[model samples]
Target: MKTCKEKALEWGISDRSVNNMCKTGKIPGVMKEKGVWKIPDDASRPVDKRVTSGKYIKRELQEEIKPLPIGISDYVRAQSEYYYVDKTLLIKEFLDQKPLVSLFTRPRRFGKTLNMDMLRVFFEISEENTAKYFVDKKIWRCGAEYRAHQGKYPVIFLTFKDVKFDTWEATLDKIRGLLQEEYGRHRELLTSDRLVEYEKEYFLKILNGNAGEVELTASLERLSKMLCTYYNRAPIIIIDEYDTPIQEGYSKDFYEEIIGFMRNFFSGAFKDNKNLSYGFLTGILRIAQESIFSGLNNLTVNSVMDEEYDNYFGFTETEVQALLEYYKVSEKKKELREWYDGYLFGNEDIYNPWSVINYISRGCIPQAYWVNTGKNEILEDVLKIATDDITEKLYSLLQGEKVVARIDQNVVYRSIAEDPANIYSLLLVAGYLKTPKKELQMDGSYLCEVSIPNREIAAVYKTEILSHLLQIGAITRTTANKIAESLFANDHSKLQKAIGEYMDKSISFYDAGAEGFYHGLVLGLIALMDNQYKITSNRESGDGRYDISMFPREARYPGIIMELKWQKDMDIESLDVLADEALDQIDDRRYDADMKNDGMKDILKFGIAFSGKRVSVKTNR
Candidate 1:
């Protein structure tokens, strides 16, 4: 055995590194004597991992991939600690077009916050010269004209991402706290001779966080002036997720109060402030111009349909392909595309960045990562008061059908529930729907043919619609569970009784047609067992099209086939006879033949008859 110093000399590394390895047990068969490490002569060098070299360790270990970043918006940490997809070029694109005030509206978790941070780091005139963060990134090669803007201006970056609150008072308090924090970053200005006495008083009030409502309302405009005084240059402003508070206010009962304050608050800083060089804002929806950007004429809004900066927010196919190739999971690309791809930003195809990172970092198991982040409050709210026609359209979307509507990109939140097209517009901007094809009408309106973007978003609609049914008492979890249990146990009477009761409660939307309504009801009920059953509908099997088929992904569970007939003229007494005839039709058509071919040994068939709110069920095993 030898001291760590001897091993360091032999391995041509620092003695401290060897001592650290010994202390952390990375070096095997080493012991400590007194205050020093004694290393075994036969100890081979462990691979150095102290510095990230754009390559991870071998894929055979328990942690084959680097840790996935969650809720991390710092560009430096994200690039250093994890496998980062380079979105730094977003900075270059912003510099190239340098809009006076640019507002980008994209759904949450689409790298908006992180991209904002990248802009702050690139543009803020700091003494540290943070160009090291973008050393080898794509933005570094966009030519010197673009690179010259790096660290060239004073920047005031603030994110209203967490300003969502249930009350106006609480929301105001949070904004005051954020302003105080930003002021603390420049507290050194308090002693500068450049600041006049009155300006100093206002700065001190904001810095101490004891400002009145009037002062707090004008905080951003005041801070911009102060920053200009201190730096001798106007500062660029970046506000991220700017509409979170407005959306929350509308959901809660304080929309007018919040809007009144915000209209003045934004107009003060952005409308005609000479201290402001430019501004940037990002959110999920563009609250109407008259509502928020009341008098800001220089503002530019780039929504999902805009061609400028289309590839900046989400992952393009080329970017996703590069990431998959780096992780050596190229074969999983098709599955990832099916789940996370299909978002259309401008004319470019985009994938959800959050879902893609999680899928690769979690061993490539495809899941609805983006959908499970937060409650779909906005979507549920829209569904609560949706008209019958809108409800039918939602059901069609779940069935992989396309919905066409004239979408107004600038949404008026207060009046969204009044128009069905507004609901489709909300879903489109909120990242739930995507247009695979569109046409420009002669009247200057876009005829967009939209559908659920991908499987992940489809799962979101399924979960939310199921919850809506439960909330309205159209169905109950106990009844759903009972149905699954009875189907598995071949308890025909119990399952039949539950279906009749559920149908009776869910008959309000039958104007679309009895067959379609009953079909949607049964489909929603079966979706509850989606984990165990791969349910399909209106597909060719044997010699005819079956209404619904629940084929167990696991062969252990029995296959289920359901046939339904709606009678407009039958009395309640003859419903049983109609149900028996439906059963005979299922047998005559050999609906079970497909299940048999698929190697399902146990099969259960159900025939259901519906008349108004009454239902009859008969089964064969």
Candidate 2:
């Protein structure tokens, strides 16, 4: 029998992992004595999926699908070991146009980082024989025009997706670690006769992770220059999720420090750096000008709304159909489309590849896979501090309705709070919202009609954003229960009194002049009955929009409709008349026509009028 350490060394897994496996009884015939494990001499080496490595192989892997490549974004391993969708044509398309600097922004989990890694493998002059991984891929058939560029250039690939530090100091340390790893790859530069002694010293400092802040900031540009001199070719720079640090900083109260550092770092590396042949960046949002890309005029941004390169990020309908067919679940295509295939990128309908893959891998059971994979803390943070106007629009979106807004593809993080439109713009880039119909204006701007993408995203809004609204609006369980009790009993007076008390307590709700504030509050109150009623908002059944409507899912309970009005120029005495006017409008407009058409009997309609903290509610049979 061999000890645990011996078994770990033989199997090439960590000792801790081997110990854990032994403790969990995964390893057969293992004996423990005096705190040491004795593993069997002939024990098989169980598969180690934690790390990827082999003798004399940096990225080589055996072809199999036993351990599925769920989150493996590395092109080398994914191509060799997993069921890979051929997105290699993305390389051909990118090379065909060959923009000087390209920024492709898509929502998270749309294969942005994986594509960036593919570009690195294809372009970087490495000894991994990366071309062999793409032998049967689509890019291989694009002829010599594209094939000639493979393994031809020096490449600098960096992903800043994990630089989420609380302080600028920790952020710098994280960046230094990444730089050190990169610099270690080119450590032969220290012995190169062409480089000066001081340059060698600077490179050594970088590899040791002891470089000064200034040295680290200029590290990329310096590395590119060094690589150009070594390889006699300008390096292709690819940065993945480049805006992650800035986004985190803005949400975490260190925006200025990060932006200042990144602006200088990017300007030095990208602006007028002769060592750069071309650069590619992938991020969730294209941060606005005068921030990161200051004075860089040669940059080209291709957002989700852009027609060019739209098919490169997400899975197209045909691609998803083929994927389902390959898995022999072709009959489930419709179900998949309804849940995950509503993302409209330009004119093509796209599916969330991450969610679809997980769904298939998990026996074709549908789930909110994409939404649950990561924390939507950034979005929730922004919404918690949202003004009344933004909250109302968000409520409309939650109700499965569209809103027209001027979408700025470029999102400025610093101004996101002050500018309400920035919230919509950020959500658009982050995949929380999608534009169905977009019109280009004469002034080079876009007027977008945006809404929630699909049921999955709407589920996220309901769980995360709506729950936050409930908390911010101070609609507690007691309050929600009280409101529901009043609605079920059709007690308009008690409901009005309860709502007026709530409005009085919330200073922001009372002070908000936007009509949506009152509308959203009523909707939020009704949302508490989501378990008991099929609540809907702004459904067009009559001549005009009805503010709120609730139909009990079971026929035994009564259906309810509500119309809300804001008394703009009225005293306390005028509220009753305004409330009566609301009731008259609800009947005159026939707002309950759809509910009645659905065979809903004994519908309860309520007209609610609001003037600041005073609420007047009237119900009719």
Strongest candidate by lDDT: 1
Q: In candidate 2, list every pair of residues with a backbone clash.
A: none
Cα lDDT listed for each candidate: 0.81, 0.78
Candidate 2 C-alpha error for residue 385, in Å: 5.2
Global local distance difference test of model 1: 0.81
**What's the CA error at residue 621 for candidate 2, in Å?**
3.0
Tell me the spans in candidate 2 whose CA falls farther than 4 Å from its real position. 1-68, 385-389, 478-516, 526-547, 551-557, 565-599, 607-620
Report the C-alpha displacement of residue 489, candidate 1, in angstroms.
7.7
Runs of candidate 1 exceeding 4 Å displacement: 1-66, 440-445, 482-498, 504-523, 529-621
lDDT of 2 by residue, 325-429 (tens): 766789999888877888878787889989888888899898899999888975676676677667667767866678998888765765675676777777888
* Candidate 2 lDDT trough over 10 residues, lowest sum: 56-65
